[model samples]
Target chain A: MTFIDMLGAAERQNHSMLCVGLDPEPARFPGRLAGDASKIYDFCAAIVDATADLVIAFKPQIAYFAAHRAEDQLERLMAHMRRVAPQVPVILDAKRGDIGSTAEQYAIEAFERYGADAVTLSPFMGFDSVAPYLKYHGKGSFLLCRTSNPGGDDLQNQRLASVDGQPLLYEHIARLAQGPWNLNGQLGLVVGATYPAEIERVRAVAPTLPLLIPGVGAQGGDAAATVRAGWRPGAPIIVNSSRAIIYASSGDDFADAARREALRTRDVLQAARADSLRVATP
Target chain B: MTFIDMLGAAERQNHSMLCVGLDPEPARFPGRLAGDASKIYDFCAAIVDATADLVIAFKPQIAYFAAHRAEDQLERLMAHMRRVAPQVPVILDAKRGDIGSTAEQYAIEAFERYGADAVTLSPFMGFDSVAPYLKYHGKGSFLLCRTSNPGGDDLQNQRLASVDGQPLLYEHIARLAQGPWNLNGQLGLVVGATYPAEIERVRAVAPTLPLLIPGVGAQGGDAAATVRAGWRPGAPIIVNSSRAIIYASSGDDFADAARREALRTRDVLQAARADSLRVATP
Candidate 1:
């Protein structure tokens, strides 16, 4: 199935919209999992097992595993996702962009090698960088729209000279996502939850596209406000919470804590969506 | 010494401006060196040993190594650069970007783990993402400005609403590199050789900063035009060629062929720079 259909099935099955980010820092992992490859595997494995039913997707930040040279651990995580929670998609948050040939290598690495259902991309190099990734019709690619960082405003928020109207640089990108740049129908945008107004702007342009909204947790984004601004009535929106859910605690109860946090966020997202629907109808 | 200083010393001594790209692929290696870790290591080792003195920098595109799960091979390439061509800096062409914390992990991956003297960065997420990589005082970060692809025009070339005289997106990024964004004076821009006009535009703005110009060989970039457009006398600019140089021949003489191709590109670049210098003089 296509990534959208896969996501739809999972959302309907679980009645949730939570995406748990697996950004495992060795220092932040529990004491038992420190300095051991097997332990790292077990930590992620248990977390996945504990929370598989509570969420729609799992985001594995590529840098966290790659920092420790634990690509194997990430591969194992992908394997576990397939074996246990095949319905829930795995989005690899790599944010990589490069020239076409090099991007082709990354495409194989992300999809063919690591088996990610979706991958986050940086749109700096423009369409050629994204083209190789888009060829995988079965998968999905989320381009950075308005990022959720203080420094993000530096470039992405620049006002572009009028084409049809005086839109910000990110708006131009959103239009492109809804335009020719999006060759396949599997394209989405990553509008950080910290900037709900920007999310609303993006939502208006790309009405039906899936949006991977991060920054709702540790980044200090108001979750309810973000959901209200980000949700499209029947759209597939995955709100990601990495640190808040995955590292909910560093003790032996880490897995259980992760499940509890994910469950809570899932419910909150559902409630916010319901409220937004009511407002729209009334 | 900074990456600029190292590259400058090499350029002045070698009288060459070519930067060889070491994007090794295992399947393309000589028949003898196949199906082993030693094959991947040997391919890069042989190429570097042959071309170390012919060029001022060696750019190992991280995806080429990471795709094959030969990150250790990449580590070996970095080590080999330090040991053999200590005067020549290695630019880790990862083109990585993310939010601050994730950027920190990537910074550690490139600078701390791989020990690269410089890295290529995607400017999509703006300052905070680039900030972590820039924290390495001794290292250099080459921000993507105008990439060498048809699809690059989709975003980087958009005319920004005049914050500073209606400059294009890439130009704004270059001006930012010269102004407040370049904290420690080690920032550079990647203006692809394919777009000589954009290269000239970036060079005109960031006069003294290094420009990592790719697309010189297989990407249909005019080497002479690029050298003329990109060269700033007494500036440390690098022109990169990957597939054309590294995979020049899949035969047993691959390393030798690569050296010959690199030496030729180096000489042509030198001739172009000298002509430009003569024009500027009298």
Candidate 2:
């Protein structure tokens, strides 16, 4: 299935918009799990077992896998997801950007090699750099529109004079949602939950595209505010919680704690969605 | 040694400013070599052996390795560079960017896991995103400035009103070379050779910083024009030619042909530098 279709089914079937970020650091794993090459896959496998029915997707950050020379563990994790839960897609958060030919190689790295249903990319070099990723017609490409970081304002917040009303760079990029940049119908933008108003702006620009919303939990973003500002009836905004959910406890019951955190996040999202529905009724 | 120090030593000893990009593709390789998983390593080993003395640095684009699921081959390639020619540094063209924690993982992947002397970065997420890679005090981080791609105008060419003269986005990033961005003194920028005038602009802004220039060989960028526009006395601006150098011949003599191509590129750069020196002698 196409990534968006799968994401829709997962969100509907699970009744959740929460995306569990499988970022397993060796230092923060459970006490039962040995901090070795296999720790990442084992910890993630247990967590997936505990919370697979509660999340719409699993966003695996590539850095943690490569940091410990645990790439074979990453391969095993993808295979586990495929074998155990095919409905929940895996969005590899690589955030890679390069030229045409090099970008094509990166696409193969994300999809053909690593088996990601979608991959996040940096759009610093513009359309041609991201074009190669879009060629995987079945896979989704999440461009970094307004990232959720303390230093995100360094360039993305710069106001461009050529644009009408002199919108910020992120807004200008969001406007491209209606342009030829999304020719393949598989393009999405990453609008961070930390800035709820910016999320609203991006939603206004491209209401049809899916939004991967990070910065909701540990980054101190208000979950209700994020849903009220960004969420809609049909738009699937996958809100992610990495540390607050996955590493909720370091004890023997880490997986159960993870499930509790994920369940709480899902309930928060559901409550917000219901409130939005109430306000929408005229 | 630091990236700049090693690059300077190699350039002086070899009397060349050429950087051989070892981006091996199985489909484009010579027929004599078997298309097994190790072909990338064997081909690159031969190419490196043939042209070790003809160039200053070796840049291995990570996409080629990751595309074929030959990351182990990449590890082998880095080992080969250390064993065969320790003087010439390897600049891994990864162009990765993310938040602080995720970026730290990528830094570990590039420097600790694969043993790259330097890795390319994208400045989309700002200083903090590029800061983790800088923590590796001995390693180099090349930020994406004016790339050699067709869609560079998408955002890199936008004029920001916040600047004094409404400079292009790439120019603002170039100005960072003079600020707190290079606190580690191991930073560089990737300015494509496609636009010779843009090369001059970057050199004008960051006179002391080294520039890794791509688009010279196969992307229709002129070698002499690039050198004439970018070369300085103490500053080393590396001119890269990947396909044009490595795939100079498709037959069994591919390594020898690659050497010839590297030698010719070095001569072209040398003549341009001489012309600039004679013109400035007055």
- The TM-score leader among the candidates is 2
Off by over 4 Å in 1: A34-38, B30-38
lDDT of 1 at B12: 80
lDDT of each: 0.85, 0.88
Residue A111 miss distance in model 1 (angstroms)? 0.5
Candidate 2 local Cα displacement, residue B126, angstroms: 0.2
| DockQ result, candidate 1 | 0.77
Candidate 1 interface RMS:
1.2
What does candidate 1's lDDT look like per residue over B199-240, in tens digits? 888989889889998888987789889988888776668988
What are the per-model DockQ values?
Answer: 0.77, 0.88
- Candidate 2 lDDT, B1-282, residue by residue in tens: 888889899999999999999888888888687466569999999999999998889999888888887889889999999888999989998888887788888998999888899999999999999889888877988899998788998999899999888888998898885467998888889999888999999888888888999888888899999988888898788888899989999889998999999999999999999999988885
